[model samples]
Target chain A: MSTNTTTRRLTMAQAISEATAQEMARDPRVFVMGEDVGKYGGIFSATTGLLDQFGPERVMDTPISETGFMGAALGAAAEGLRPISELMFVDFFGVCFDQIYNHIAKNHYMSGGACRYPLVITTGIGGGYNDAAQHSQCLYSIFAHVPGLKVVVPSNAYDAKGLMTTAIRDDNPVVFLYHKGIMGLSWMSYFEGSTNEVPEEQYTIPFGQARVVREGSDVTIVTLSQMVQKSVLAADRLAAEGISAEVLDLRTLVPLDRAAVLKSVQRTGRLLVADEDYLSFGLSGEIAALVAENLDTLRLKAPVRRLAVPDVPIPFSRPLEQFAIPQVDNIVASVRGLMTFKLD
Target chain B: MEATAEQLRWMYEKMIEIRDYEETMSRVYLEAKLPPKIQKGLAFDIGAGPVPGEMHLAAGQEPVAVGVCAHLRRDDTVVGAHRPHHFAIAKDVDLNAMTAEMFGKATGLGRGKGGHMHLFDPAVKFSCSGIVGAGAPQACGAALAAKKLGTDAVAIAFFGEGAANQGAFHEALNLAALWRLPVVFVVEDNKYGISVEKSASTAIASNADRAVAYGMPGVLVERNDALAVFTAAGEAVARARRGDGPTLIEVKTDRYFGHFQGDPETYRPKGEAKELRQHDPIPALGAVLRARGLLDDAADAALRARVSGRVQAAYDFGRNSPYPEPQDALLHVFAE
Candidate 1:
């Protein structure tokens, strides 16, 4: 798969739709099915033009039963149909969790490996939409804990397309989290036409490598999803103060790039984990703990700082939501906080 | 009735095996050593005898399974919910495997990893799914597969009235109708989902009413009377086999216990359960057979004893079976 070098521009949503379309085109059995996925072309338009292209049988529009359609996707896969089921909101995962965990995850092992239930379950995660209680949530950690399930969390348009393609092609069941906020994010170089454009041909990017979005040696800021953008802004602010900060964008959560994180920490001798979810059990907390517990090679550093929302649900009000999520200012304050942290 | 008297006897024996095995499971988990949840949900972990856990026993639901399974061939598949003992028995899965699964042993169905809520037995073409209203679509998938393979083997999905509210029910019924995919949708209205009564849980009094939305035939049956359920299921199954499309069969029955073991159910009106007890299917059928001169006390007693012995054996096998190994636990994520 070659990267597009032209000046053609597209949003993250467009990239994802392109990847899905290419995969479905490559495999006749690969079909798209979900609520409003056909005629409506998905709630966020991620499935645009598929219904007309593939017709109603393949690009199916399903009733509002995540559990049923989700299970059907796996069962169909077992019967030799490559299916991609969509969950409109990742927060609504509880209703159809059985099909995902029980039916899809355990089918092969239960039958003694006589089957391959390949499925790409895509769902929209994260909040900046003011969708309130049930609509907005980042539950990757809950899914990340499950065995036999691969999780992909992309921070940019290019990675979003490539990682999703990889998830679709995976032999095991995979969950791809599409951040709502990043769908419309402006990529300065690619989508903005200021830099190279994505190629039109079929391609996919590998998972687990953390992209060093902005390089600096004074301190390292590790984050993922939309938080990566916020970390970049924080780094820019730190640069103005001559406190250079390195920012790492964790494209995937499950096969986490620990080596990159450790190296960055060792180089900078200081670390700050900026996360979208609650601070206590988030990926950041786990990363910081791993570094502190085993960072004997990085002895010249200060205690790792973490910039995560306290343990609380995402509130509805704008201010409350801001307080519940890590913002650019929060990252800046956190980077400043780590300048004098002492573990000893 | 084209089948011989021996086939009928075998069907009855399978049903009885499920019943007696469930009783054995209850005894072991309760008075013997297991918990009620483990005992009740054992139907899934083991071969599909009396269905277990969180959902009520299909003790009274066995005849539905027997009568329906009586029609399906080996390639034909069936999907069931939490209380799915009857379907497992109908499919003829290994009793020992079902029991071992219930105990979370390696030898069990799904290597004890599936637990009771997620039972799978490819042998009998029965897969016990725990998701409420989840199995219907999978049944549709199986039917779609059979159709694609040009096989007349119809897939039947047995669920509850509570699941009729689920999105899968609507999606599947519509698909089955649109494609004539050879599927039968049986809704066992067991009267409750946990404490939510069917009358309270569903906007429509009967799930059969929802079938109108799919532009298909939806019928209500008396679950307490096995003959009625048999007759309804027969027509529906036949219609699906003939490629006429899908049928929604809602069997109205009383669950007879709290939603689960130790539920201390206090929702029903006083004596409502007592009033429903007189309509129990087993005795009702027994009375019918006696009046028709088709049953003798000696034969009936012999059948019960035989069923009890077999169930006892299954219980012994599951109880003595070794637990799953810790390292081997990771095996089989993907089938080869």
Candidate 2:
């Protein structure tokens, strides 16, 4: 890795669109379809200028039909085409879950290997802008729970581009979920940390690889997507207090980086899982289980703590929404609590 | 072309088989689910049945399946809604394996991973979903596959009237019409989607009318007769096979049983199921065959006996089959 390589700062959405445009240009089989993806340039600007370059045949705009386009993508993939289908929002999976889970995620297995769905389903996730219950959700855990889907959630623009390129090239179905709060949209205030220096050249990031944003020895804050930024901010604040907190951003959930998680937690001896998803039966619980299962070799100074959304619909009010979703303050407080813990 | 005598007889026999199979399932699904074997204060337990989980039996809706499937080949794909047995049986899915699947046996389709509503028989190009209106887009996909592969195989999606209101139905229609994919959408208007009536859930009286909005020919089968469904489905299938485009056909059928077997159906009116039973398509088709001098009393009895024996043997196979190993549930989640 040469640090002197030419790189330009790009937003998460621009990075994703660049990756998609590069892949489409590289591979004749790669095409994109979704609502407002063609002329309007995607609701989150993930496919900004593809229509003009690739034409309607490649970067087509689909009707507002998640089930229709998602199933069509699966079908097209089954017929030797790589399709990138956007679902506007992850919360809309309810209306078309049958196509997502029963077909897209299960067809290859159910067909006993006769059918392989090489497709990418991209959707926006997380709730920081108070889009209410139906419009905002970080439901990547639900997709990760399913068997056939590879779940990729990138934290920054650089990883977003690389991971998206990998997702589009994967033979199996992949659900690439991006947090709207981290996309750097002009309308919504985003974490500037998510916008990073991305190379103009095409690149790919392997799944199941976790990136340690900051190396520390006291506590490990394991998170992904939007929470990674918050965790980083909390780590920065905790660093001033001499807590020496570490932040681990899990890039993919299905092919999870179990080794990195265990190695980091093994080093720190204190673990705090910060997630934007629901509090129970989700990524937090899954991470906790991983630690508990490896307790025979790993030692811990304090119990593992979790900071996530409480079990409730994301409220429209900013105060309620902020209180529900894990914020920098919550992560800082959780890490502080872990620091003060004693083995009574 | 009109229906030949042989095709009519085949439709009648298939209808009888579907009716007998569904009736058998309705009875078997109630076993170990009633009073005294359940927890206190509960009228019935859906989970306590021999065939556990919710069972949506297509008893009086045999015509829609037989009619549409009669025009389908083994290579043609058929996607059915939650109440899917009739379509599965009509598509010639293995009766014993399908029955065993509902029984959650290791010998069943999907190896008991998919219960009654989620049967996947790729050999016959047949699959179904437990979700309402979920099959339309998938059917389009299958049709798109056939088109891309340069084959004449058509795809059929069988959903309910209530599903027409779902966004999937509209989107699939527009997509199929836009692509000119060889697919046929059949709506079995059985009056109710779970407890809500068609009049309550759907805005229009007929789902066929909605197809025209998507620039496709819409045909409505007013009667729940097999011959009527056969004629409409034959035309739609022919149009699809010719690569003309997609067509939507709505069959005014009857749901003999509740949405699921354990449903109390307090939302339905008194004598509604009884009224639907009076117009049972199984016997109605039999009369049609008799009027054409194609079936005598002896022939009808022989057909019924043959169908009943097959249905009973399937139930026996299901009942005798062993349950899937508990650990086996973890398998088949992904392809190796």
Candidate 3:
């Protein structure tokens, strides 16, 4: 932590672009390519100011050809160049998942280590600004489920910079998912806690380490990305009600920090997985299974609870979308419900 | 660029090898799939053979593979679509490993993770995907890699006519042209995308013409002739290697079998495949070789015997090879 008095608080978007700019300036092998990642400065502002800094060759604006550009990224990575290709939205993965999963993800393993794809696919995730079913999704769980690709979802500006640096430096293909709401975009309402005092120096955050955002003893909220922001708010409000809630942000899903999750739940004795991704067969179930499989050493105060988007598309209506996606109040209420159960 | 006698002889031998391999696979794929081998009342089962699961054979499309691959070098990359054995064999991929991969053996390419459609042999720089139109973009990527790495090695993507209509095909063409990549897109017009005729699926008559929209030259081989494909591919490969950018070549080819091993193919007109087989490119290429004094009866018999030996040995190796351990399925998910 930088204790300088002149510390500047940066948005998640600025921190991401800063990290990319630093890495690009340091490593000539690193470059950026995507639709509007150059002139438009990224739809979520993740690549803002990169085009002017690095010029056109390093910061490329691609045609609206996801498969072509994504495959080109894979090829470039295989040839020993590090490419940061941006998918405008995570929802659009369906159009080019063949290049993503079958090639970029599996090429290293399929080639028996003859080839390595060191690339970062950065895509905007989550729903809040009525981007409907097609545009609104936090499908990092889907990417995590597939083998060979690392999945990183950062909750705040500081973690975004560190994790994006790590993802770029990684020798494997990584999907760096940033929540649109947490990027501090002007058009959408955001959680203020997502803006943080990030250090200007380049740093790398190793994957599979969970951050204990707020220490609590009552119940633990296992979450990630935008839900981490909401969990912090829920934990703050729960303090007023004398219901302490520990918030654990799972920074990366592929190399998931099971020990951090189990240790937190061991002390709190209760678990509530708050996620913005879908409800079924997803992160919530995996977290619950992690706890359930370790019942010999752990005692549970209640059955594990989950707060996630119900198995429906993110609705266009505001109330319906909020109802489907887990919010701060939903996390607070879930914690309150967990407090009701007694071990005896 | 014209193919010399050596190139013509090599193309003829490879076409014969591919034809023999596909015919053998078609027969082997049906060994235990009939009514008696499966449960009662079922006429046929696709998943009950020695080579289980869906099998797509390229019996009548050997000319397309041999013609394109004849101009390729060991360093060049070839990306093939679903019906990929012809491309794999023509690209000099290990016959034993590829066959064993189809049989799901541990010694196979990809260690049996990828089957016939998804063979990835990095040694020969040959790979294929089961997804239609997926290979085009990947081929472009390989070409881009060569260009960036300062190599004259070109790449070729072999796809069916149906893939030409896919968004990936158009996108790859545009990207290849925009970047001036050293790639050649070869469309094997087998006339059907699993029963839907090209007339019904494609709006345009020839997919080669679609190349103009992406600012590339389009060449169409009006017949299923190996020499015609060789000449077109040689020119395209030379153009790509000389940094002339990408080209699109469409070969009017034939498919003598159903889409898959067990496909009823009731959608086809009666005797269409039989009628198409009368102009089989394998014998036609042999006739050309014979006319050019490149082949005699004794030489042709000797070549057939040699090709048959190799194909039979590959099939035997695949059949006799051991299946991978059950727990091995969890391996190769990631590189260490």
Q: Whose TM-score is greatest here?
A: 3
B170-274: candidate 2 lDDT, tens digit per residue: 889999998899999999998888999888887788889988899999999999989899999999999999999999999999898888887889999999999
Q: How well is candidate 2 docked (DockQ)?
A: 0.28
How many clashes in each structure? 14, 0, 0
TM-score of 2: 0.83
Better-scoring candidate (lDDT), 1 or 3: 3
What lDDT is obtained when candidate 3 is compared to the true structure? 0.90
Residue-level lDDT of model 1, residues B1-336, one tens digit each, is 243354456555665676676555555544422434345744323222232334346666666777677778877888888877778877877877877777767677777776565567765677866667778878877776666567788888988788888877787887778767788888887788877887788887888888898889998875556567667778888888888888888887766555655456787677875676666666666665656566689988998898787777777777788887798776876442
What DockQ values do the models have? 0.34, 0.28, 0.44
TM-score of chain A of each: 0.92, 0.98, 0.98
List model 1 lDDT by residue over A271-296, tens digit each. Answer: 88888766787677789877977667
**Candidate 3 CAPRI level:** acceptable
Error of 2 at B7 (Å): 2.9
Give the C-alpha lDDT of model 1.
0.74
Error of 2 at B108 (Å): 1.1
Better of 1 and 3 by TM-score: 3
- Superposed on all Cα atoms, model 1 deviates from the true structure by an RMSD in Å of 5.6
Q: What TM-score does chain B get in every candidate?
A: 0.88, 0.98, 0.99
